[model samples]
Target: MQIQDLPYPDPGVPDARSGPRFLVWLGRNQLGGQLKALVWGLLHFLSVSALPFCVGFAVQAVVDRSGARLALAGGLLALCGFGIALGDTMLHRAAVTNWITAAARVQQLLARRTALLGSALTRRVAAGEIVAVSTGDVEKIGWFVEAVSRFTAAAVTVVLVCVALVVYQPALGVVVAVGLPVLALSVLPLLPRATRRADFQREKAGRATELASDTVAGLRVLRGIGGEELFLDRYRRASQEVRHAAVRSARMWALIHAIQVFLPGLLLIVVVWQGVHLAREGRITVGEMVTVYSAVMILTYPLRHFTEIAMAYSFSRPSARRAARVLSLERATDGEGSREALVPTGDLYDPATGLLAPEGRLTAVVCGDPDAAGELAERLGGHTAESSELPSALVGGVPLDELPLDFARRAVLVQDKDPVLLSGTLRELLDVPSSGDVSPAEALSAAQCGDVLDALVQGSLDADDPMDARITERGRSLSGGQRQRLALARSLVTAPGVLVLDEPTSAVDSHTEARIADGIRSLRQGRTTVVFTSSPLLLDHADRVVLVHEGEVAAVGVHRELLHSDVRYRAVVTRETDDEAAEQELNQLQELEEIEETA
Candidate 1:
């Protein structure tokens, strides 16, 4: 009944545990509700089991021709009918209530896992995959949970009906009992192959969804490079492959469908043919023969569900597996030590690079490999920047892994170059994490986004309210420079102890980037700031620059000192810069790289 009992046990996962086993665990945990629904469902089945016997009684009463007895039998039949209707409605309602609560618990588990993982969710799994799990897979798993009760009900109904018929008329009852099972079990032979095909189809569908999501997320970049047509062609080919996979799955299901429909019909024929012989031999009364016939006819209804429940179960398994896998990913390391012990009021250090960002000081990292620089920035933030399995950095005197998660997160904030902007007005977007004390105006002024704010209504809450214009997803409505600036502004507002920025102004023009660089250093005075940029203007603002060569720090000094001394650093930072004054200073470093290469 509690939220903790849901299926999701891990945050980032592709669990290999079979779906059936998982369901058994859930059922065990919620045994009370499961038992309640099971009882009600059985009662419903028994009420239905009374129907065939009632029909036989009415017929036998007519044959006997005793008016009083006939009236009594008819009244009994009516009473049975009322019981059936009432039991059926109540059982259905109880089963449905059980399912809703079961599903709610699962949802709560998934939600809790999401919160535990935070932004790390996207690193471990695709956004589309998460979307699919929460929307489609959750529903299917819930459906499977509810169907368990219905299946149980149908099974009980069949068993009780078989026992009743055997007691009433041995010869005809034997046929009814045996024939019904054959109808129910017939679909079993086809289920595995059908389910295998369905699994393949589901995998392909997930792939297509992930691909579409990736394409949409990077649509702007693709559009910029003139490769939209090429990407579209590849996506079209993938789409066609998915279509073929779907077709194969559908054909298998079709075969299963055909078998389920025809098998019961065969069983019905056999039961009826045998019953006629028993009646002719006077082994059973005419009314008893009618009862046997009615039982056989009604058995098919539950037997049909036996096939259907199997099919639903087969379809639901793959979806549950998909959801479970996504839910099972290991969370990034969070230290369990005392919060105060992990709290950093000092420097950040990376052993891998042999670099230390001394406390409350501006530090810049310039690397020939931009990726290494970005990654270094992320580890220093106390989390993996992306989904790689790299070791993290130490903050103050302790390894980040030894710090309490909430404290580590609060102490270090990583501001990626392409920071996401959710749909909201400029002011609301600026106030990420939505604190009551921080003013939007102060954040904008710090981000140097006054012009952006003016362009948006002075303080309007909307394109609707005039102060808050909703940005399109990822701030698609804003230019790249504007988005970068807004993201910087948002981070500045937080004012965490360590601000790690990777290529903060990579997308902006020289002039805008220069102003941004100028504004950032002044605003972030007396803070431990790491800017991972090759931009000369931005590099100039750093109090000290550490040149990362390959995966290590090649050199460390002021921007001018590194430019004069480190050639590899020069070749990178000088790229696409128009800082006319630093030309001689830049080329000197480039010449050193050429000399080093020749040597």
Candidate 2:
């Protein structure tokens, strides 16, 4: 693929059977670019190899006192210089293109895989591991990919240079040619040790990254529980382990580099020594001695590529493996059933919990077990695993798991308890693939986020419009309630056929909660909406409230009726045990509602 044609329309199905296979697949797909790079690399290294011949011819011309031949040699030297310059420049360009394109392709594939798996991807892979794979690992993979062509060129140049030296003067040439292979192969014994150290360092670094991610994600909670220093100390230990491992890894590579430097220098010294003896004995010309000496020095340049390619492979192998592992993960619903968009808008039925939110109505589910509630919420949106042991939820008459993922998501949008707000402008955040039924203004008004808009404008440095103002990553700049309200507004803007919200207003005060409850009921009129919450404010607005006890629907009725009728429902909703006190609270809330209605 050309550099300009980056971000391929489709990266194609990857061979994720193994890390090595994946890397091979990447190279195969970019064979054209690799070949282009290889050709340039050949041109560049071949030009470099020709330089010593030009110098040897010039020296011979000088000794023979032939000015014409000397001038010809000068011309050849200039030509070779031009070739070296041209080839080197183009070779670098081609190699960098290959690197960037290869990295872009991998990123696109990873992004596609991420989209397919959604939240489940993180459940399977650690957040930090995923981060490392996408960032550092991708670069390493690209490094190896780009290094291949140059290494091939370098190897070919070494072989050609060795043969030419032998043909010119067999005595000195044979020794130099034989010694080159030994020099190249000498570092092989040290590679395994270096690779092991590198792997150890990579492991330590990955652990440290994972620890830091976990610590930052829960920084707020950590401070609340006074565990910041404990995590800090743990991270410090991990960081030190990473440092020590890196030092060990560096030491091994240092030895390899020393060997590379020392062996090449040794071979150079031997070649010069033998060439001088051949000159003294009149077995080889002085010009030949010069040629042999210069060629040996020139050959050392290509030899360095040997160690470089080794280093590239050593680092890239593990990176490719990590990327392969992530790509290999399949969504739980993948290949479970038909891949057709056959879902119809209707009631959401979770067979596992026997909970049904009827069509075109607001249904609130109160589950004492928060975990069970969250699971049920996920099931309603076809987020179940492929395991047949866990039954798929249904919509209309068809099982949600049987429908296509895109269709299921479009049909039902589930807002998690702690829904995330990604960084963007208010306009961008609300810019979803909506049904066009709800305008941003209407949704914002319904979500009671006027204050959120004001906050955005107030926080901005230049932009007066909240929609133009930038939101920080994860909306860290906003209050929890603000984030929740904005998320709710975004969900409302989508105007999905069925909207499922789990404790969407948990962070907001009761005053805002009651208004949000009214907003949800009003905006979602004639649409199927399922809310998993125990807040009486929200429950009271639901057309039907289902109380879930022991993972099953225990009771179903209007909120006020269930409050007085079912003891478990009352206990779960109000968190009150005394019937008298529960009624008293309910009465007070009823009075407030009446007064608001009168106002």
Candidate 3:
């Protein structure tokens, strides 16, 4: 396959996608609104153009000694002001709308990509990176998009002003026209450094955001370990780094701003100086000179904005690059799994680990590496990948990639260890995205969540519609086990053809874990289920067990059989037992001893 056809490597590069390409992609989605905004911006710019011409006309009228010159000049000024106001309003409204909508659309598109990648996004991307792109970078991209119209309008305004001056009087106009280019172009020399400074500022901001998210997600654990202060200090250090970066960035911007103001003022001096020379030489009328001076003074408004837009883009470019990388993230697809309604009345095979679950049976996965187990679980659920011809992993004899995405999702569901439980009622939390046809009672029974529901009723949700009871955000109030069972119960309610659960019973007591294992097995009867775990209580319920070793399947049999046959599985499962506590430090040595004994 050609290189362009390949997915982007996880390069950790800034502005992940090329700038021109990203704009083209965005344009396809927003060109219409952008065009409309541009049209309005031009009209507004034209309205302002009347400023220079009217001044010149008023001067000529006064000089010619026609009708009440002052009154006519007042009327012209009012008319030009009215046009300016009308154009300004339209320009402002259109530009702002274009920016907000463009940002929102990009937000929606990025969110969709995140959903498509699901948990995989967190796996491949850092939490800080995602947080930065979604919150800060998105607004910048929108700002840049909106800035396009303003930039165009400013250019047109410059042209109109120059042309008017030249038309009124050629020699005077020539100097003004040529002089304005020099003023506008002066900022160009300083832009690169300014852009670089803005980019540095953005990078610091993203790092700060990343550090904050990490701290929050792990705050509880930090508190437990008494490392809160240590982490706080680390965050302080990170904050300091960001502060330094920000200061450096601000210095560059400060210089740019100073230059922006200073250059235009200098340009004004040049125009005024040349105007006086021409007026004294009798090459241009005094009135003409006054009008020219007035027009040149006004040029600062658009010129200032032009430089600012460039400044905003420079600061925003890094963010856009970050956003592009996220938007471009591809959902790894599994090549296996049936696309059609997975009746799933047959065996589930994972060639990657060589684990096969006979149709209508319970199978347990025992792995040395938790991550490997999780990856296997994802594959078994029919998510796709690029590394394999069979895609990432297969389900029900179909490549997950080949299966229509929705069908694959429904056919096989992977319940992660730490499931995200959005705030909602006990019932609402259990039923995600509207679990309409399924009764809450049935799901509760399947999940063994009656106690959880009862407890919430005793709390602030202590009202009618207890099932519709409000949950604290992220289910923070719920115990770890409750959350796990709730997640499992929800998965059970979905009743996917193949259920791949990663450490579903990890948080519960042994007694509870045992019950959950049985409940899951009974509820999933006549369906395929793969449980990634080495807990003896859960393992005992499996019809068969497969041990994943170094990313591949090493041994397969009944759990009891593997306990005797697989030393690694035994070491992992029993390593946490109370009986093994005394030998915990020596477990590695003990495992080696056991292997030697077996040999």
Weakest lDDT window of 10 consecutive positions for candidate 2? 334-343
Better of 1 and 2 by lDDT: 2
Q: What is the C-alpha lDDT profile of model 1 across 276-297, one tens digit per residue?
A: 7777887788888888777777
Report, for all candidates in order, the number of backbone clashes: 17, 0, 18
What lDDT does each candidate get? 0.73, 0.88, 0.73
lDDT of 2 by residue, 127-179 (tens): 89998899999999999999999999999999988899889889988998899
lDDT of 1: 0.73
lDDT, residue 161, candidate 2: 88
How many steric overlaps does candidate 1 have? 17
RMSD (Cα, Å) of model 2: 5.5
RMSD of each: 4.9, 5.5, 6.5
Q: Is candidate 1 or candidate 2 better by TM-score?
A: 2
Angstrom error of the Cα, residue 371, model 2: value is 1.8
